[model samples]
Target: MPSRTEAKGVEAISSDGNLSTVHAQTSRKERPPVDSQDGWNGTLQQSEAMAPVYDWGPEIQGIILSSCNYASFLVPIPTGYIAGIFGAKYLVGVNLLLSSVLALLIPLAADAGVLSITVLRIAQGIAQVMVFTSQFSLWVKWAPPLEKNQLINIAISGHLMGSFITLLIGGFLCQTKVWPSIFYIFGGIGCAYSFLWFLLVYDDPIHHQFISAGEKEYIVCSLAQQGCSPGWSLPIKAMIKSLPLWGILVFHFTEFWIFNILVAYLPTYINSVLQANFRDSGILSALLLGAACIGTILGGLLVDFLHSRKIFRLVTIRKLSTAIGVLVPSVVFVSLHWVRFSFSASMGLLALSSVTSTFCQTGALVNILDIAPRYTSFLQGLSEVFAYSSGAISSTVAGFLISQDSEFGWRNVFLIAVSINMSGLVFYLIFGQAKVQDWATEQMFTQL
Candidate 1:
């Protein structure tokens, strides 16, 4: 990705968008003076004219967000199971509707203080889990065997793009003095999208009202060969013992640990350490995640190409993508602390690292469908349960590390994230495989 100097036109948006100059003062009493002698030009005094809408401080803000993150996977297992049993179309629709309504009320909740905001965030987290659950369920029926990687990766890319837009637009809005506009606008978009989702999408091709007979027949036939049916009972014992399944869960957990840190803290690093103003910080952050969006699409294409050519077995292809995604980025994350003092270098490493990490969208994220298409939603929920549970620790740790804004503190954060990333790689290498598991087609055993 190009350096921030290359990003033009942001000045126009910031200037026109009610931009407020943010001067972040060191909130800690004992923090040493920045080495003004080091030629760094990142800090400035707070603009007395730029009054904040709320002054919850960093600690309270961290708790509110962390509380939300912790709640994200709390109900996914049951939620996914329910979606699988009853069908996902309406469940997903309702989830989004409820979440959007809550989002629109966030400004009101925030004014009521941390307790209200925390309650609202936790509720939103519960609702948001349905989005992941329903999509995985839909994929189990929608994705053709040969096109699985490409199809799923395309859907996953939406997350990267959404984050890109959020950071870009959200930072600008935060500067606009009417910070509440952030929630209102996005919430409104979500509500509108939910209506379209219900009208256009269905749980399966069999149920899609508008699908052509030939297309529905093609889909039903393909999935029938895989032993997919309406049975809701999952093979709990076999799933618990499956090495490949556990590998997916462990690696997903580890990967999200690093992912959570980057999502939650990168903007802070840019704003606090690099002393970049709000507009520049938003642009820089969006640029890195935009690279991530591109990486997801490219990785999907490469995976499908290799699969088509028979260059390697599916298992090998998955393992190779995992290594590229997790291992390379692990090294890059560790290198980030080394380049922390250099704006372009640090941002460059982070951008490269995040993009590489997203290649796992084609690897680990899609591996569940390969192993157990019949139970993909349930397995996805199980994996997310582990992933989000592990990820929730990251925010708390970040809060502790950057609490005093010490250089060594931030360095330790990078080291811990690197260690987690590498650990996940090792586990996945040892146990991961990308073939159909026997339990997924249980009827085969009884019939034989």
Candidate 2:
């Protein structure tokens, strides 16, 4: 098989038959070269790409987002198992180091002509899982209950931003033949951020040196009000057996299938069906994800607002949000079959549908904490296992569908996503209970 660069070159030739390799090289020579002083530096600059143009708050927020997003795609399967069997701290350190090492190795692998793209991508996926899950646990520990929704939104929004940025920037990098540079830049920045995170983030607010006494008291009290017991060990068996866990797991699996199909495969759809360029595809993908980011923040705020008013109970809020989120998107997806429109119009509808779908994720995603704070990491791991497994299956099936099609065919794939999401929603509606049941209440009271 050809190298990634060679494959891209071949694609360019295939797309534009008039563009010969020789002509391309000659054209490059005639064009004004990028200035080193201007910070072009022969590759995309991380600082420059998203510098003063982006606000500092969002930038830091982006790093946190990228950290989670990186983990979502980059962390290895082995690292996830390690996190399950051991603890998060070691997994965090190991994944960070491993990702950096892989970043350094990308060029070497390219040079040696032996790096299997599948394996390289899998390594990245594993590292990403480790980092994000670890950070999630830390977020749960440090954030006050009243602020948990907002904090969780911020962290997950990081994930959304990371996905958006990667797709947006990765496309540019691929177009410019600097794809490997993207990994190097992200890896280097991640390594540096790992150090800063280690120094600044503590497991709990009480352990944090910089937090004010009043802040600490507020955090502790907030957690208590949320029914969390400080220093409690996870009720591993009970969590595993709970109906809520299963509901969340099923919901996560469905959402992830939808997310992966859209984020990973939509660009290809745009390229094939819309006949759009890489830049346009990237922008469209970013728009879809940007909608998700907005949806998640809004969902969190909506839940918090509801809680503040005491109009709806927490459990009621979670279930209702989750139900609408899944149901509405599924209906929208089905409607796509009837509505014939331009590519841009279709994408806009898809984005709207996706935003509605993502609202469910905020409630379902945070439910693990409500049900079992002590085993939040482990529960997240379990949910991730189910979610990614479904995602992997969806991606493979999607690829198969695309390959078998003679013409642009994303309809079947979207149908599959819609079906699965609707099925999950039905399952939750039938079996998912918002309140802690009698058995769980009895067990908790006994333990107390």
Best by TM-score: 1
What lDDT does candidate 1 reach at residue 192?
A: 85
Candidate 2, residues 1-448: lDDT per residue as tens digits?
0110110000000100111111111112122233212433333344234311222221221121122233353333344334444545555655666666666555444344322423454565566566666655554445566566766776576667656666666555544554455566666765675565556445566766776788778776776665543223345566557776788889888887777666555665554455555445566766777788788778777777887788898778877888878777777667665553476567777787768876775567778677666546666777777776676666656666655662434677778888888777777666666554433332453331
Report lDDT (CA) for all predictions: 0.68, 0.56
Give the TM-score of each candidate.
Answer: 0.86, 0.75
- Candidate 2 residues lying further than 4 Å off, grouped into runs, are 1-90, 103-115, 230-241, 335-341, 436-448
- Give the top-scoring candidate (lDDT): 1
Q: What's the lDDT for residue 15 in model 1?
A: 12
